[model samples]
Target: SLGQFAISENGGIALAQISNHYLGNFGMIILALIVIIACLKTTVGLMSAFSETFVELFPKKEYRFYLLIVSILPCIFANIGLTKIIELSVPVLMFLYPLALILILLALLSPLFKHSRLVYQITTAFTLLAAIIDGLNALPASLHTITFISVIINFAKDFLPFFSLGMGWILPSVLGFIIGCLCQITITVYKNKKSSTLS
Candidate 1:
């Protein structure tokens, strides 16, 4: 539900056409990725950066109550905002891809995010190219741990459709899990570094 309103009364069709064009097929999407990369922006980079920064200063695993109390409400609130925006006009949400793209950039670039501009630039560039490649390629399905976990989660979610919107909630839940795991690993690595330095 994109919350974008047409500036004029007759602009709804124009907006829909734009959204349709943008979300059309692989060729257009790949071209869009190329354009987005040429401009140096992505969702993964943004999310991972935020996650890293958040974990760095607030790395206390014991403060789950304080952290969840403070964080969960905002996330839920944001989801509500998204739901309302979707209600406004789902088509415009496609153009609102920047936020989601930034999160994707964060997740993809997490392998390189740190306290260095050089690292951020390198990771950002790498993530841009990688994302473009991912967009172009049909990623092979593998029988790996992520695959197994996804399958089991999908199976479980099948019985719990009440929590799902329309389709299974597995996709969004899996994405959230992936981001969470990335943050967890980053924090774990940070903890190990501190331990080594102390040792």
Candidate 2:
């Protein structure tokens, strides 16, 4: 709920403006209080999550150590400023979101494939490759301007369906899944035939 408020604060302000037009000063004060509280709550929750992750990752390190690191790290990022952080994070989020989605979708559909490792491996490999390319495309202009990267980006845009939509992985992942299923079926048949001949 705190996260939702943080994300929707701009829209909440729009609603507050409409209320302020009719309710005058009282509505504005209430909106201001709500916004402040929501921001504080969300920030605390985010920091807690970050610190906990680090603490868990480094089991031998004391919780206080990870907590201190997490607390201090954000100050450095804040000194770098919010806009720059957003600029850097947006590209990474763009790159990661597709792979995340594929994993989630595959997890949900796992039972349909009988939890096949071949299917998982194949789909994940294709998704990873596409995600890496998409991530490279999202790099800062100087990095992206390299000749090899530019050519690869151009080739992907020209040849891959949905590359422009940040969904370049979909077709390839699906193809990989299909191919993997086929391979699994062929292998299973071969195994059965070999066992039958041995018997």
Candidate 3:
């Protein structure tokens, strides 16, 4: 049973424990091999993408240099252990996930909005603000005691709808989108009127 496996800071241990219990040493070996292959493929893909992007952005830097930096940094950071890595990543993931979701939503609704950059920018700006607050809230408990962060968290909880449920960004994002659509309509109308007057 899953409950029989001891819990640890590294959640992956449970899977290993389960496999080992069910199938003995061979199962553990196979699981480890699978994990290694998975990690290797992911690392390679990420490194290649990062290196290519950096090379384009900074043409002076060679791809090899970027690859080396990415490789070395992760190697160094990996020494911190899985628990620490997860702890550091949680807040960052919290911050990015909402912005990513909002961008995807905007893309899907682009036809209705005529793919207006103004609409995307305004909505993204609002979502970014809320995402920042959520990220701060997700920070380590020790950091929560900081006066400014605590104040911000308290303020969000008091006013932002669904904040306690971690969906506070929803209302603001909707409002921004509506406002963006209105601005786009008003600008389009003004442009048409000016063109008509000139003709």
Name the top lDDT candidate: 3
RMSD of candidate 1 to the truth, in angstroms, is: 20.6
TM-score of each prediction: 0.21, 0.76, 0.92
| lDDT (Cα, tens digit) per residue for candidate 3, span 4-94 | 8556667677777888888999999999999999899999999999999999999998999999999999889989988899999988988
Per-candidate total of colliding backbone pairs:
19, 0, 0
Of 2 and 3, the candidate ahead on TM-score is 3
RMSD of each: 20.6, 5.7, 1.7
lDDT of 2 by residue, 56-154 (tens): 887888777876887798778878655577668767887788788988988899888788898888888888888878887787888878999999889
Question: Model 3 clash pairs?
Answer: none
- Candidate 2 Cα errors over 4 Å, as ranges: 1-53
The local distance difference test score of each candidate is: 0.47, 0.80, 0.91
Q: What lDDT does candidate 3 reach at residue 52?
A: 99
Consecutive 10-residue window with the lowest summed lDDT within model 3: 1-10
Model 2 TM-score, 2 decimals = 0.76
Ranking by lDDT: 3, 2, 1
